[model samples]
Target chain A: MNGVRKAQTSPARSRFRDEDLPGYLFMAPWILGFLLFTLGPTLASLGLAFTKFDLLSPPQWIGVDNFTFMFTQDQRFWNALRVTFVYLLLEVPLKLAFALAIAMAMDKGIRGGDLYRALFYVPSLLGGSVAIAVLWRQLFQGDGVVNQVLLWLFGVQGPSWISNPETSLYTLVILAVWQFGSPMIIFLAGLRQIPAELYEAASIDGATRWKQFWRITLPLLAPVLFFNIVFQTIEAFKAFTPAFIISGGTGGPVDSTLFYTLYLYQEAFAHFRMGYASALAWVLLVIIGVCTTLSFLASKYWVFYEDER
Target chain B: MSAEAGPGQVGSEPTIVGVIARHVLLIAGSVLMLYPLLWMLASSFKPEAGIFSNLSLIPPSLNPKNYIDGWNALEVSFSRFYWNSFLIAILVVIGNVMSCSLTAYAFARLRFRGRNILFALMMMTLMLPYHVTLIPQYVLFLNIGWIDTILPLVVPKFLAVDAFFIFLMVQFFRGLPRELDEAAKIDGCGPWRIYWMIILPLSKPVLATAAIFSFLWTWNDFFGPLIYLNDISRYTVPLALRAFVDSTGTSAWGQLFAMSTLAIAPIFLFFLLFQRLIIRGVAMSGLKG
Candidate 1:
C-alpha cells in the first residue's frame, strides 16, 4: 500500500512541486512554535541543570554538583520518586481492570448503556481539574461529607482523608481510579471491533461465557489494553494537579502526597532551584523513556496488533 | 477454562437473578459516582454550619447567599474570568484545527526527506511529560515578557506542540481514502488545495474531535495560569476559584461550592452539546485512529 502511493505521488511529484511548498507553509506556525516553545526551553533546561539559574539571577555553572546533590544528597527526591512509584503501581492496574470490566459490562448491550458510559466518563473530564480537586478537598476534609457519611453509616470515626498523611494520598488515588472513563471508552470501541462470528462459533462449541472471554475477547482486546496501560501509566506518573490543589501546593501532611512532578514544580518555582529541577526533569524523562521502552518490549509477548509484520 | 457451571448450566440458574444482580450493581455504581456532585449541590444551599454538621443529600434550608457571596467576593471579576477562559478555549480550538490537521496531513500523505524521523520525534514528544518542559517554558515566557498574558497558553498550541492532537490528526488523515487525494489532484489541485478543498471538508469528524479536546484542555489548564499570570486581575476561572481557598479567613465552603458548580456547569453543557461527536472522536482516536 505504501509503495503504490509513493509511486503514484513520485511520478507526478514535479507536477505538484508547489504542493510541498504549501504543506510547509501551512506547517510554518507549528515549526516556529516547536523551536521556540518546546525545543528552546527543553535545551535550555538541560544546560541549566549543570548550573544555578534562578529567575532573578544569572546562571552560575557548577558542573555535576546539582546531579550529585540529587542522587547523593537529596532525600526528598528519592522520597518523591518512591511516592510516585507507589502511586503508579497501585493506580494503573486497578484503573485498567476497572475500566475494562465496566467497558465489557456496558458492551453486553445492557439498557441505557450510553448513559452509563457518560456517567462513567464525567469523572475523567473532571479528574485532573482544580475545581474537582478542591471539591475533593472539601469532601474528604475532617468534617467533610465523606467522614460524616461514615459516621452515619457505621457510627465509626474516620480520619480526615485529605488532611492526614496516611489517607490524603489515597483520596488522590481514588480520584485517579475514578477517571477510568477514557480507557473504558477505548475498551468499548475495541470490544465492538471483534467479529461477532468468533463469539458465535465459540457458543456453538458449547463454550461458556467465561471461556469465551478468556479465549476470544481477551486476546482480541490486547492491543487496546496495551495502549490504555502505557498512557495511563505515564499519566499516573505525571499526575500533579490533584496533589497540588488538594494539598494546597504543599503536598503536605508531611509531604506524603508530594508526587515527583509536584516536587519538581516546588523545586523549580517555589525554591527557584532551576538547576536542580532541570536535573530532576531529565531524570523523569529518562524514567518515562525506560518505562515506555520496556512496555513496548513486553507488549511483543502479549499485545497482538492486527496486520503486524 | 470453563467454571463449575458452564453456559447451559448457567442458563439453568434463574435468568431473573442474573438480570437483577446486574441492575443492582449498575444502580449502586451510579449512585457512588454521582454522590459527590449531589453532595456539593446540596451543601452549596446549606448554611455554613450545616455544610459540616449534616451529611444529608438534602439540606434543611437553602442559603442562596452562597451564590451571591461567591459572585460578589471574587477578587477577579467572575465575568472576566469566564471571558478569559472562553477566549483561550476558542483560540485553542481554532489553532488546533488549522495547525494539527495540516501537520497531520503532511505526516499521513506527503513524502519528504526526514518525514519518518520527524514523525517519530513528534511521537517521542508525546512521552515527555509536560512538567519536564513546563518550568523552562515558563521562564522563557517570562524572559519574553509574555508572562501575565494568555499568549503563552494559547500560542504554543498553534505550533502543533501538543503531540496528542497532532498524533490524533495523523491517524484521522491516514484513515481517509487515497482516492480522495487522487481525484482532487486530477482536478488541477496541489496538496494545499486538496487539503483545503478535499481533506478539510472530510475532516469535520476529527476536527470537531480536536476542537472539543482543545477546548476542554485549555479551559481546565490551571498550571499555565498559575505559573505565568501573577496579576490576580488576569486570572482565569480555575485561578479565580483558588481565591476561595483561604489560609487566613474561614474557608468558604458555601461560596466555593457555588463557584465550582458554576464553573463546571458550562463545560458540562459543552460536553452535552458535543456529546456524540466527542465520544465518537475519543472512541476512534483510541481504538484505531
Candidate 2:
C-alpha cells in the first residue's frame, strides 16, 4: 500500500523508478515469516492472553480472566516472579562485575591472553548446552566435587547445593557468573576503544592506579557497562536451559530454581495451559521491556559517553 | 589487540614480584574457570567405581568403556542423536545463510517502499522475547500436524525467522561499496545476479559467521527440541543429553558424563579451529552500533 503511495509521491528518488517487485521478491521469505511466525504468533499470544484455549476446544474469550488469575490467584506466578527478579538482579551485576574485572586484567596486555581467553571463553561457549547443565548438577551434588573440595579444604561438609532449596538458585547464579566470557569480551572491546593516552595523561598527572581506574576507566567504560548490564539482564531473565536441565526440567527442589521461562514452559507445554501461559509470557515481556526501557532511561544519568555529548 | 587500556599499569613499570603475582592470580582464575569442565572430562575418563570416590584430576585408567557403552546406553545409539542434531544444524545454517542474506540484500541495497519501516520492524524482533510467541507457535504447529517433528524447528529458519542474522548480514552488506552494484547493473546484471555473483562472493565472512552461529545455536538448542521432538529416535543431542539425565541410574553419571563430553565435542572443535572468528563474532555483536 505504501509502495503505491511512495511510487506516486517520489518517482525521482528511484533510479529505476520503483524497486517494489525485486525488493518484495527478495524479502518474500522474511515477510511471510514475519506474518506467519513472529507477528502473527505474537498478536495471537496477546489475544490468547485474554482467553481460554486448549487444542481440543476453540478459544473462549474470557476478558482479562487469565490476567486476573495470574495477579490474584497463582502462587507459582508470584514465586516465579520473585525467583526471576532475584536471579536477574543477582546475575546481571555479578556477571558483569566478573566480566569487567577480568576484562581489565586481561586487557593489561598479558602474554598468553589467547590461552586465558580460550579457557575463559569455553564456558560461555558451552554454557547453553545440556552438557554444561549436566556438569553443573554433578559438580554440586551431595557427593559432588564441590563438596569434596569443601571438605578437603575447610573440613566442612557442604549440602547438596543443586538439590538444596536454599542454595539451588545461588548455584544458578554461579552458573550465570561462570559464563562471563561473552560480556568480558565486550568489556575488552570497550576497553580497547578507550584511548591508552588517557591513562598516560593520568599517569603524567601523578594519578595513582586506583585514582586512574576511577577517574579514567570507569567513567569512560560506563556506556559499555550500561550495555552489558542491559544485555545480561535480558539474558538472565530468559535463562531456561541450565535451570531446566539442572533442575531436571521441573524447576524443582520446591521451585527454588524455577526461572520464569521454566515456569512458563511447564504451564504451556506440561499442563497445556496455553492461555495462562500466554498471560505469563506477556508479564515476562513487560518485565523485560520495562527493565530495558528503564536501563536506557537510567543510563542518561550514569553512562558517560566520552565522545557523544 | 595489544593495546592496553586497563588502568593497573598506570604510575610505573611493574616490578618482577608484581608480574609474578599477577600471573599467578590469572592462572589461578583460569584454572578456577576451567575446573568444572575439566572435572567433567576427567570423570568421563574414570572407571565407574572410582568416578565418585576419586576427587583426583586424572583417572586411574583411561577407560573407553563409558564412551562405548554410552553410545548404546539408550534404545537407539547416541550416533542417531548426533546425526539428527547434525542434520538439523546443517539445514538451519543453509536456511539462515540463504534466506537471511536474501532478505538482507534487499534491505541493504534495494530501495523498496516501506523499506525503512520493515527494517525497523525486523530490528524490533531482535529484542522481542521468543516466549511471547512460543505457545501460539506451538498451537499453530499442532493445528498443522507439524508437532512432534523437526519441521517446527527447521522450517522457520528457512523463512528467516531469526532476524539477528538478517541484521548482521545487512550490516556487512552495507559496508560493501555500492558502486559495485551500479557497475554490475551497467553490465546488464539484475539484482539477483549482483547478489549471487558480486555480493555473496564478497560476503563470505558474514555468511560464515551466520552459518557457524546458526549451527552452534541449533546444536545447543534444548527448548525447541524439548517441546517438539517426542520420539527418542528423533531427538537431538542436547535433548538426548537431557533424557540421559532422566534415565540414568545413580551410578551412571560416568556414562552421562561420557555422552555429555561427546555432546561438547563439536563446539569445542569449532572453538579450537575458529577461536578468532568466534570471539570476533561475539565481540562484534556486543559492540552493536
Candidate 3:
C-alpha cells in the first residue's frame, strides 16, 4: 500500500510543479477579497483611529486625542462599557448553563429528540433578525403578553421590561438566554462524544448519577464548555440588532440599553464621528482580544483533550 | 454514533414516572421558548386596539386586514423588500458556494509556499468582529460609489470574505479521502476538473449546509444593508420591517407585527424543510471548533 501510494504521488508531484499556478488562481478571489476588505480596512481603521474623519471632510490627524477623549471625557463611553460588561456577565454564564442543562437532559435519549431540538433552535434561527427584535419589544411592552401573563397568573403588574431603565438591559439578557439553541446544540454534540462505557464503569463502581456527571461528564466536556464560553462571550459583546431595534436605534430609555456596538454605530453613522467610532471599534477589538486570551490562558487549567491525555 | 444509552446503563429502563417528568419539563420549556413567536403570530391577526388590550392568542375575529395594511403600509410594498432579500440571498448563496469551495479545495488538496500562513490568517479573520472592519469598508465602498447599491453587500461574498464558510468547507474537503484525488490526477484530470467533477459532486451535504446558512444569514442580515443601502426602495426585509416602527411608538404596531410574521415565515418554512441539514451543519461547526 505504501509503495503504491509513493508510485502514484511521484509522477503527480512532477505534474503538480506546474499546477501551483492553478492553485493560486483558485485562491485569488479570497486573497483579493481579504486584502481589499479585511486587511486594508483593518489597517485603515487603525490609522483613522488617530484622526478625525466624518466622511465629508478629509481625515485630520489628531494623535491619541480620540483615545484620550474616550478615556477621560466621554461619560457615554463609560456607560456603554459598563452596560456591555453587565450584559456579558449576565448573558454568557446564564446562556451557557441553560444550554448545558438542556443538552444534558436531551442526552438521556428522549423520544423524538430531533423535533424538540429543532423547535428549541427556532429562536436562535430568528434571534438576530430585526423582526424578532421587534417581536421582543412587543413581548416586553407594558401591556404585552409578558405583563398580561404576570397579571393573570400572579396578580402582579409587570414593569414595561424594555422601556424601564432599570430593567431594559435585563430584557436583552433574557432575550440572549432565550435563544440558547446554538450552544445547546454544541453541548449535545459534545455529550455524544463522551464514551458511554465511562458512565457504565462509574455506575458499576457505585458512583451516583450526580457524582458521575461531576467526575465523568464535566471533565471530559471541559474543552467544549470552554469553547462555548469563549464564543458566547464574544457574541454577547458584539450584540447589536436587538438593542438597536428595541431602543429604536438610539440606545435609549436614557441609554439604559446602550450596548457598546450600538453606541459605536450611533457615533459612526448617526453623529458621523467616524474617528471617534474608529477608536471605539478598536477598543472593542482589544477588549475581545484580551477576553479571548484570558480565556485561553484560563483553559489551560481545566480544558482537557483526549489527544492531550 | 453509539447506540442510544439510557441515563444510567443499557439494561435498565428509565422509570415511567422519570420519563413523564422529563417530558413535562421539556414541554414547559418549549412553551416558554415558543410563547413569543406564537404571540406575535396571534397578534398579527388581531385588530389594532385588540393587539395591546387583549392577550389572547385567539383573536376576537380572524381579521386579515392587518396583513393587507402591512403589505402596503410603507411607501414601498412588502413584496419589494421580500424580492430584494431573495435576490441578495440567492446571489450570496451562489457566491459563497463558488468561491469558498474553490478556496477550500486549494487549501485542502493543494500546497504552495505560504499556504499554512494564509490559512492561519483566514482563521484569524474569523475572530475579528465586523464592527472593527465596518467603518473602513463603508469608506472604501463610498469611494468606489458602491454605496446605496447591493454591490457592497453582495460583492464581498463572492470574494469569500466570510471566513466561517471557508473554514467549514475546508473541514469538509479535508475529510475526503486523498486516494480519490490521486486517482483523478492519474486519470489526467486537471485541478479544475478534479475540483469541479470529483470534489463538488462528492460534497452535497456540506454544500447544502453552506448554501442554507448563507441564504438564512443574508436573508436575516440587517447591518450590511442598513449601512450600505440608503433608499427605502433598495431596502431588504429587515430594513423594511424597521421602517414600520417610528421612534415615537405611535407607529402601527398591528401592521408591524403582521409584516414581521410574514418576514419570518420564509425562514420558518426553510427551517422546517431543511431542519436536518441545518442542525447537522451547526453541529459540525461547533464540534469542529
TM-score of 3: 0.96
Q: What are the chain B TM-scores of all models? A: 0.90, 0.94, 0.94
Q: Which stretches of candidate 3 lie over 4 Å from their true place?
A: A1-16, B1-11, B247-251
Q: Superposing every Cα of model 1 onto the true structure, what RMSD results?
A: 3.6
Best by lDDT: 3
* Candidate 2, superposed: residue stretches over 4 Å from native: A1-12, B1-8, B11-13
Candidate with more favorable, higher lDDT: 2 or 3: 3
Interface RMSD of candidate 1?
3.5
TM-score of 1: 0.93
Q: Score chain A of each prediction against the true chain A by TM-score and list the results.
A: 0.93, 0.93, 0.94
Structural similarity to truth (TM-score) of each candidate? 0.93, 0.95, 0.96
DockQ, all candidates in order: 0.49, 0.63, 0.58
i-RMSD of model 2 (Å, 1 decimal): 2.5
- For the second chain of model 2, what is the TM-score against the true structure's chain B? 0.94
Clashing pairs in 2: none
- Ten contiguous residues with the weakest lDDT in model 1 chain B: B1-10
Against the reference, the lDDT scores of all candidates come to 0.80, 0.86, 0.88
Give the per-residue lDDT of model 1 (tens digit) for A95-194.
Answer: 9998888786667546688988888888787757778988898878877777888899899788888878888888988889978888999999998888
Instruction: Mark the regions of model 1 whose C-alpha exceeds 4 Å error after superposition.
Output: A1-18, B1-14, B60-63, B247-250
Best prediction by DockQ: 2
